[model samples]
Target: MCELLGMSANVPTDICFSFTGLMQRGGRTGPHRDGWGIAFYEGKGVREFRDPDPSCDSEIARLVQNYPIKSRIVISHIRQANAGRVCLENTHPFMRELWGRYWTFAHNGQLPGIRSKTLEHYVPVGTTDSEHAFCWLLDQIRERFPKPPKRQTTLWRFIHQCCEQLRELGVYNMLLSDSRSLICYCSTKLYWVTRRAPFTTAKLKDADVTIDFRQETSLQDIVSVIATEPLTHDEEWQRIKTGELQVFKRGQPC
Candidate 1:
């Protein structure tokens, strides 16, 4: 299985603190050493960095750790390959254009017979069942709504239904976004934490590091982080229920 990390913020915020803890799990602190990738949304454009190497040892991962790329939405993954070879194409956080906007997806689990499900439009560029499931999901959305829907809740509910269908196939924990909304679904384990005004210091569980978010954020800022596991030892992380779907916009759950 892989690990997922996502962020939705009211204001553009860097995920360096949380990402630092997650990277440690790639090889140093955990066994997910197959590969890693991340996608950062800036307006209508998305910037992605991927490597077919353990995130803890990758120089690119170090650069991302050092650089503060502020974005309102971010999705990242660290893989422990189960269905695909350890290559760049098999890396998580796959990106594809949808409805005039880029949709980014990162999955943490597998579907053994997912490829048997026929797809209409989107196609996987890799062999991973994770990527195939993502393509099939987008195909379903495109089939249901040829154009973007007017009511956002309708789209959210439809996406949840699609996820529930996929969940029936196998473990389907995932994070998806279309540059505006962050969607998370949990089949087994997932957790989230939101930080806002009156922020306090947070200590990482994987690394001996602490950050005082008050010094880095404003009173009006709201930032929510979703991860496969709790990244911080000091902060209270809410566990998403099994088979539940969550939609977040501007750092608030919808």
Candidate 2:
């Protein structure tokens, strides 16, 4: 299994604090150290980085830690290979172009026999069940609506339906984004927290570090973070129920 991290903010924000806590789990606090990757959605563009090595020791991961690239939506994953070989090709948060926008996906569970499922348009370059499922999901969406739908609810419900079908196969906890909205689905576990005005200092669960968000944020800034588990030791996190599909926009669940 892997671990997932995501962010949706009303204003552009860097995920440095949360990311640092997660990076420690890549090898130190957790066992998902096979590979790691992250994607940041900046308007219509995406900044992504991937490495087929333990994030705890990877130089690329270090660079990501040091850089404060701000984005409205972000998704990240650290893997402990179950369905694919440990290599660059199998590393996630995978990205693809859809409806003229870059879409990012990352999964934290295994889907046995997922490759047997048929795909029409999108084909995976990697041999992981996670990637196969992602391609299949996008293909289904493309088939359902040749162009973007008139209503966002239509697309959002369709995504939930697709995720439900995937959940029938196996554990399907995931984070997905189309550079506009962040979609999260839970088969087993996922937690989230929202921080806005009157923010307080939060301590990391995996690292001995703390951040006073009040000093770094404006009164209007609303930020949300989602992870496989609670990232901060002091703050309360809301867990997504099993079989739940949550859509987040501008730091609030919709």
Candidate 3:
């Protein structure tokens, strides 16, 4: 299985600290070393970086770790390659356009017989089952709503239903975003943490790094991070319940 990382912030925030821990797992501290990719949603646009090489040694991964690209929503994944070949096209954090907005998706587990599903609007550019499942999901969303819906909960509930159906197929831990809200669904393992005012210091589990968020953030900042496992050993991360779908907007679970 792969690993996932995502963030939703009330204000634009950088994910450098959490990403650093995840990068070390690509080849050094863990086993998900096939490839890695990340997407940052800045306003209506997204800044994406992908590498088909092991993140521990990839120059592009190093650049992303150093670059402080701030965004309100973000999604990332590190692959272990169970379905598709280890290549750029098969990387996670796949992007597509839907309802005039760029939507991003990253999957952590394998789904069998996903290719047998039909798609009407969206299609996969890669051979990965993750991408195929994404296309099918978007197609279901678009088919139900020819245009974006007025009430947000309607779409949210529909997404949860769709995810539950996918869960019936296999483990479907996923992180998806539309540059505004992040939808997280857990079929097995997923954990999250939220930081607010009077933040404290956190120590990374996979690297020799520590951050005093009190010095780096303000009293009004609210940031939430979700990962396959807790990135920091000091923080109290909450586990998402199995078969639960959580929608995060403006850094709060909605």
Model 3: per-residue Cα lDDT over 1-254, one tens digit each: 99999999999999999999999999899898899999999899989999899999999999989998998999999989999999999998999999889999999888998878988888788899899999999999999999989998899899999999888889999999988799999999999999998799999999999999998899999999999999998889999999999889999888
TM-score result, candidate 2: 0.99
Query: Cα RMSD to native, each candidate?
Result: 0.7, 0.7, 0.7
Off by over 4 Å in 2: none
- For candidate 2, the per-residue lDDT at 104 reads 95
Pick out the ten consecutive residues of candidate 3 with the lowest summed lDDT. 114-123
* lDDT score for residue 117 of model 2: 89
Clashing pairs in 1: none
User: What's the TM-score of each model vs. the native?
Assistant: 0.99, 0.99, 0.99
Q: Give, for candidate 2, the lowest lDDT window spanning 10 residues.
A: 108-117
Return the lDDT, model 3, position 71.
Answer: 88
